[model samples]
Target: MTDTNPIPARLAALKTMSGAELKKQWRALFDTEPPLFNRRYIETRLGYRIQELTHGGLKPETVRRLQDLGEQLDGGNIATRRIRTDLKPIIGTRLIREWQGTEHCVTVTRDGFEWQGRPYKSLSAIARTITGTRWNGWVFFGLKHHRRAA
Candidate 1:
């Protein structure tokens, strides 16, 4: 029996179409200026776009789940779902930690960190020197929690 699903044929035709034909198809499918990306990129994106248009795209719940995953990848934490990654704190911001009843302060700098008038490459290094043990820099400085609360 002949294949009744036309989507497979449409996708296959995308692979065989000439560059100019692909550009025309892209304009029709996307209704905007074709991106300056290479032909392969155009082909792959067009293929997906065509399928999405025909199949009506992802469900709302799936889209929300993807957005949540994207937020995590961009530095959202599990507990608060708002804590950003450690690499980005404003310059001159002070991070404080208490050890053995002594207050220690770390200042964010353009290049690295400044603690106790000395420059350090990472917060872990500062934490190790202060406590004499290995520690995750983010957790040590309270940017991240070492364990997720149950």
Candidate 2:
């Protein structure tokens, strides 16, 4: 019987073999049965489902299949993303702004930031007067609104 744990020389020989020869040897290794599945199948199916969802109108059956497969595939991450996207608007509404020569971070209320430094009232006001966009210098996560350190 061939050793199930291949030695380094055997592994090197297998690596050097041609594709057709490798196929033959691989089948011979498993008594002529091909490998059952691989990562390619999962990637291909995911791509196909994404394409269907994006290109097609997302039929109910397809949506169900996608959800089922997603549950099996994603370890609860899919549900989390859905929840996060839903909650994104509530996040980053307020932030703790800090600047140079500040001892502590300030809470940015409607009137302006409150701290031992230069203050700003609102993030939008700050963004408008300081930067161009409403989301400038703000690192926002889901609706929980973690005001990250800048």
Candidate 3:
């Protein structure tokens, strides 16, 4: 189960947030929590955060970070659910759509990271696809509790 009190208050604060406040709030929320359980909780909350930002005009950098997080959560396990949920905010939103022109590297983005036929959402996703391993924060967008690879 989730924390009833903290989440509600946090959600309330998010409602009145501006673009500049978003990143800070997000960082604060994630920073306090230890690696409590799996990444599901973190991913879900982040998904909603993305949705909030979408209305404020999702910046390219934010989109890239979200996409990268999605990839990390997409190891085809329970984490995938969280990743998918996080992606919900951008489901219908327009992305830059990266193209790599190669058999691989087809990633989706919203900031024109497309090369060939790939549309990467974040750098981590790109690194994973290119390197073929679970990648954590590569670009360091200041996300809290990013689990380091063992």
Give lDDT: candidate 2, residue 147. Answer: 57
> In candidate 2, which residue pairs clash?
111-121, 112-120, 112-121, 113-120
The regions of model 2 sitting more than 4 angstroms off are: 1-6, 35-150
Global CA lDDT of candidate 1, please? 0.84
Residue 145 deviation, candidate 1, in Å?
A: 40
lDDT of 2 by residue, 8-105 (tens): 45545654656555556545543554445453443343344434444665679989999888676445564333433333234224444433443333
Candidate 2 to native Cα RMSD, angstroms: 15.1
Q: For residues 17-115, what per-residue lDDT tens digits would candidate 1 score against the true structure?
A: 998899899989999888998988998998899889988899999999998886766444343344333555887999999999999999988655899
Instruction: Rank all candidate structures by their TM-score, best first, as comma-separated numbers.
Output: 1, 3, 2
- For model 1, the superposed segments whose C-alpha errors exceed 4 Å read 76-150
Candidates 1 and 3: which is better by lDDT? 1
* Candidate numbers, best lDDT first, in rank order: 1, 3, 2
In terms of lDDT, the poorest run of 10 residues in model 3 is 90-99
Cα RMSDs, all models: 14.1, 15.1, 15.4
